[model samples]
Every structure is written in C-alpha cells, then in structure tokens.
Target chain A: MAAGNRRVDVEEVNGVTVAKFTDKKILDEGNIQLIGNQLFSLVDEDRRMKIVLDFSNVEYLSSAALGKLITMDKKVKSINGKLRFCSIRSDILEVFKITRLDKLFTIKENQEQALDGI
Target chain B: MRTLPSSKVMSSSDDLTEEFEVLIPSDTTAGHEVQERIIGHLQTRNYHERDVFGVRLALEEALVNAIKHGNGMDPAKQVRIYCRVDSIKIRIEIEDQGPGFQIEDVPDPTADENLERPCGRGIMLMRAFMSLIEYNATGNCVILEKGRTIEEAEANDD
Candidate 1:
C-alpha cells in the first residue's frame, strides 16, 4: 500500500523532464527530496532548457508541495532552464491561487502545451 | 451534550477509540499529498464539501508551517498530526519538533502591503478555514477546530 501511494514516474522528451505523481498525498519530505534530486540530476545531465511537471494525477496539493516547486523553479533558473507545470487538478489549482503562485510560474493546459510553452 | 476535555477528544462519535495520526516529513514538497488524503478521509465520512476544503486548507498550512518554519526543511524532523472527530466538531492538533515562535510574529497575509508575498499566508489561510486556531504553550502544538453547525458551536462554546 505504501509503495502504491509513492509511485512516481519520470520521462524525458526533447530535453524536457516530465514527472507524473501517482501518490494521493505529497505530504512527506522523502517524496519532495526525490522529486528535487530527480530534477537536478536531469538538469545536470542534459543541460535541459526546460522541466515540465504533469500534475493530472494529483488531486490535492499542499503548501509543502508548492514549496518544493518553488525550490525546483529556482534551481532550474540558476542553471538557465525553465520549470513549467501542466495538468493540474482544479482542487490543487485553488491552492496555487490562494498562495498567489499562479503568477510566479508558467502553467499550461496539458503536457503538450507545457513542453511547447518552452 | 457535555463538552469533553482536551485529553479525550475524538474525531467523531462513531469511532471513539480510533486514533488518527499522521507523520509529515520535514520537506515542504510532500505536503500536498498528505493534505489530500486527510481531506478525502474526512469527506468519505460525510463531511460537507465546504468543510472538506476548509480542513484541507487548514491542514496544508499547518503542515507547511511545520516543514518550512519549524523543521527548516531538515527532513530528519517530522511533523506529527493527531485528530479527533465528534458529531459536533472536528479537532486537529499538529506538533513540530522545532522551538516554538510567537504567533504575533507572523504577518497578516490579508493585509494590503503583504498580499504579494509568497510566504506568511499559511497562518492566515488556516484561520480562515477553521473556526478556532490556538497554539500550545510550547508553540510547537497547534490546535484547530471546525464545528459542524452553528448549534454545535454554541454547544461547545463552554
């Protein structure tokens, strides 16, 4: 059951790193660290210009998750790469709005748009 | 209905002995998933939609504060959450390992000058989502309450 909850898949296309989160809750530091480390590793390996996060499977998002996104965005920017998001659920979108993060990052309608946006 | 002491609070009247405990890692990135599961559990038990969102927001803020402020993203420290539900209201308590800070030190997010800041909004959002928000003496424990109805609020007023 725990394994199922933490399932996350990563795929790279055209220098864009896309991570799909299947976990019902992104509530622990381990999951956050995994995502961060993955993004950093990808950036270091490909010198990728963009990173896309597909949150379609994520029904809910917390401030901690948002914090990680912010951290990732900064790390990517420092390396001259961009971080974009797509397929965010409406419930989780509300969290972005409440925190006024809707303006901080680039958000697209879907994975295709996220990759294309870059 | 008699108001129970803080020591014996339950999530709901249906299950008096079930204890709801959650451990949140010190990383801020994982807060979203944890918040969702907690809200889902509350909704499955018949909490109103508004209440579900309210609880989610409150829990998110509390856990984020614990991770970002309390634990400083140490990852080794954990944010422990305990909840009790009764027919009248739901009570949630969050404990962090870091030294407590004064509540007054947090700036109001709703204020005009601070609206644009990305941080400092968690506490304000938590207050809006729950009926009552209180900090324990050590400052690490935060207690929040959401009453089912106005009558329930009045009943538990004492």
Candidate 2:
C-alpha cells in the first residue's frame, strides 16, 4: 500500500510549470529531494522559468523545505528563470511572515495569478 | 532510542521539575508537524502568542539542522527533543546522532551575497528567535532559551 498523504505532482500550465506537493511532511529531506530533483530537471530542460509551487496540497512546511525553495529560486534565477508560490494556507503564511521571507518572494493567491504575475 | 549527550540531558533529578519530551523521526518532512504539536502544547500552557511563535520558529530551525545536517536524512538517527518550561523562561535542547560540526563555521545568512541564497538562514533565524543560543562542546547538542517575562519578550519583539 502507498502512503496516501506523501505524494507530490508536478505539471505544466500555460507555459508555466507548477509543482503541487501533497506530502504529509513537507520538510523532510526525502520529499525535499523529490521537489529539488524535479525543479532541477525543469531547469535543465530549458522549460519555462516562471514556476508556481502550489502549497494548497501541503498542510505544513519545515524550515528545511523553505531552504530548499530558496535554493531553487536562486538556482532558477541563475538560469534567467524565476519561481513563485501560490495557494498557501494562512498558518503556513505566518511562518513566512515570521521568518521575514514573505518580503522576499512573490506570493500570489492562486496559480492563475502566479502565472499572470510572471 | 539513543541517549543524548550527558550535558544536554536533564533528568528528573535536575533542578527543573517540569519537563517535556517529544520524539520525532529524523526526516525533513516531520519537522513542521512536530513544530505544530510543540506550539499547540505551549499554547495550552498559556504561553504568549508571540512567544509561542518564536519558540516554534526556533524549534523548527534547530530540528531541521539536526535532521538534515546532523543526521543527513538517515532515518536511523532520531531527533530527541527535551524542553523545560518555567514561569520565567523556556529552555529547549535538541540532540542528533550525526557527527557534529563547529558552530563558528556556519556562514552568516545576512551577509550581502548570501542574502539571496537559501541554506544558511536556519542559524540566523535560530539566533533571532532565542535569547540564548549555545552548542555543547561536542556540537551535537543545541540549547535554545526564550524568556517568559513580559519585558524580555517585549525587548525581543523589537
């Protein structure tokens, strides 16, 4: 049997790529590696740099996962690409605010807005 | 299941009578859920909202460092957290089984070029969240303290 809660799906929309994470724990290294590998592959493929990480599927994120996102953003920017986030829950948003990362990333209310922002 | 460093362990015989313990698997994803549980516990004890937030952030940072850096994603290593809460303050100690590194070697996240980078911010956040942050001589143990007093917390708020 599979772990129903520990899944992540990556897809493309309107030339913008979206990584929808559905893991019970978003902070662990295994899950981080999954997202990181996919994002890295996207960068390598010369796919759309405008990326949207849909957190609506994630209940919570650990600092490690946040670090992974920051690293991914930097990696994308190095290749003339950008990464944005959308559909974040309020509780997780508070984590962003507390870490002052809310000021650094371009966060949108939904995937369409995130895609539009780029 | 492994025992923590002697200095980091606070047995019931210690001066502090109140203690809290939580066992979390040494996986990255477990960090957030454990953090939420810890914050929920703190709230039940009437900890100030801001203080609760601070403790949660600090714990998240430390636990990530332990699980990711210390344990290196090895599930065999477990993060054992022990906290002591008193009327005046809260002290949290986290231990990991991985070989430790020097605290001074970590780069400052606020440094100009590093500001845009992601990995080093955990230590910076930990320092900002706790009033007193220190590592045991072996470096496998980390101790973080936040004040419970109104004045101290207010000072931290700024």
Candidate 3:
C-alpha cells in the first residue's frame, strides 16, 4: 500500500511533497519499518525525490525509527533528492538532540519552514 | 507442546514493587508489543509524560538492540525482559540469547567522526534517557534505570 494509504498522508505544499505521519506513537518496531518503507516507496517506488516528513502527530519514536530516518536521508541524498522533517514534538526532539541527528538532517519547526528550507 | 511468548504484571502486597516480565522470540513485532505494554504500565502509574517517553525510548532501543543486533533477528533466539517500577524509579533488564559485545569497543555516536553513522545511536539514546545503564560482563544483558526522587514522584501524584 502507498504511504498515503497507510500511516502517512501525502500532499504537496509549496511544490514539496510532504508525507505527514498520522501515527501518534511510533515506538513499535513494525511501525518503524512500515514508516521507513513508506518513505522509501516515495523515493524508489513512486519516484518522488523531494519530500518532507511532518512529524507533528508523533509523540514518541524509537531509535530504530530514527535510524530509519537516517537511512531515508541517505537514500534521498544518493539520488540527489531532498528529505526534511518538521513539527517534531519536544519529547521526540530530545531524541534527535541527544543522538546529534539534529546536525545531520534538515529539521524545521513547522511544515511551512520545512517546505521553504527544502 | 510449544512454549509461547508470555508477559506478566505483578504488584507485591506492599505496592512498593510493580514488575512486569516478558519472554519472546527475536521478532520485532513481539518486541514492539512488550515495549508498548511496559510503557503503558508506566503511564498508568503516572510517570511524568516526558519521563515515560524517555523510558519508553530507552526501552525500545534496548529491545531493538537485543532483538536485532544481539540476537541477529533469529526467531529461534529469545529476548527476555524484566521491568520494575516504583514510586522512586523504574528499572529494566534485557537479556538476549546471543554472543555478547564489547562495551568499550562501541564507538561514541556523538563524536564528530561518527556523527553521520546510524549504527551507534541506540546505545547513546538509551544512556541519555535512562539515568543509569549497565552491561553484564558478557555484554548480552543490559540493565537500565531512571530515578524519580520521592518528592518528584509525590509532586506528580499531587
């Protein structure tokens, strides 16, 4: 199934295709892989290069999920595409900060900023 | 008869020790369920949401490490978890049926040289979220603890 049909909702904002994850809690391992594959499908299966992940709804995500974000970033970078994240809750933001992934990814405070930055 | 995965929530008569234990195959789905259950119990106990999230994050990372890195995702292997919560703090122990790793050898994830690498963040996140983290001599078992002062717990209770 497509990301839009699954845990994420896909749309275009300022010409950037954004996948807003609907899942509020993302700590589960299967949810991690499902979201990862959903994001991957956006690049590999759907051929959409530039994307932003709107994490406004996610309260918590596991490190494995964070690892998937890294993998997604690498995948998009390999194809000269872009991927950004926005609306990360403070709790989830702590994970990014602690792991120092905040330095590696383009993290925005909101969807508009993510679209503009990406 | 085949042994199935099992989980239990136990509270001693004094209510000082609330513990849960689960034994499951090295499957991500099963691991996910156990993690959720543990977190749910913590939330029900009125742990601060942020603290609950912190422990939840650390717990999931440890479970992932035990299931994926430790057990190599072998369904035949088992990952055992024990979580104990009290007014003062919560403690969790995770052990995997796999060859242990060297703790000192695990690289620092926040180091500049390893910043972009995705492999080492789990341990770092676990350390950051939990107050104390200990690895067994063999490295197959990890003990994670986060403390809330009695005052803090009572404050939350109020």
The number of the candidate with the highest DockQ is 3
The regions of model 1 sitting more than 4 angstroms off are A1-8, A13-15, B1-41, B53-57, B60-84, B95-99, B107-125, B136-138, B147-158
Model 1, B24-114: lDDT tens digits are: 7886556666665566566656776667777877887787777778888787898887877654577888888999888888776445565
Per-residue lDDT of model 2, residues A2-88, tens digit only: 344335576878778888877644655566777666666667775567778888877656667777777777778888887889999
The TM-scores, one per candidate, come to 0.65, 0.65, 0.85
Cα deviation at A52, candidate 1, in Å, is 1.6
lDDT of 3 by residue, B1-158 (tens): 65544445444445566777778999878877887787776777777766877787888789889998999999889998988877678889999999999888988888888876777888888888889999999999999999863345565856
Ranking by TM-score: 3, 1, 2
Docking class of 2: acceptable
Per-candidate local distance difference test:
0.71, 0.73, 0.83
A117, model 3: CA deviation in Å?
5.5
Candidate 1 interface RMSD (Å): 3.9
TM-score of chain B of 2: 0.77
Ordered from best to worst lDDT, the candidate numbers read 3, 2, 1
Report the lDDT of model 1 for residue B126: 73
Candidate 3 chain B minimal-lDDT segment of 10 residues? B4-13
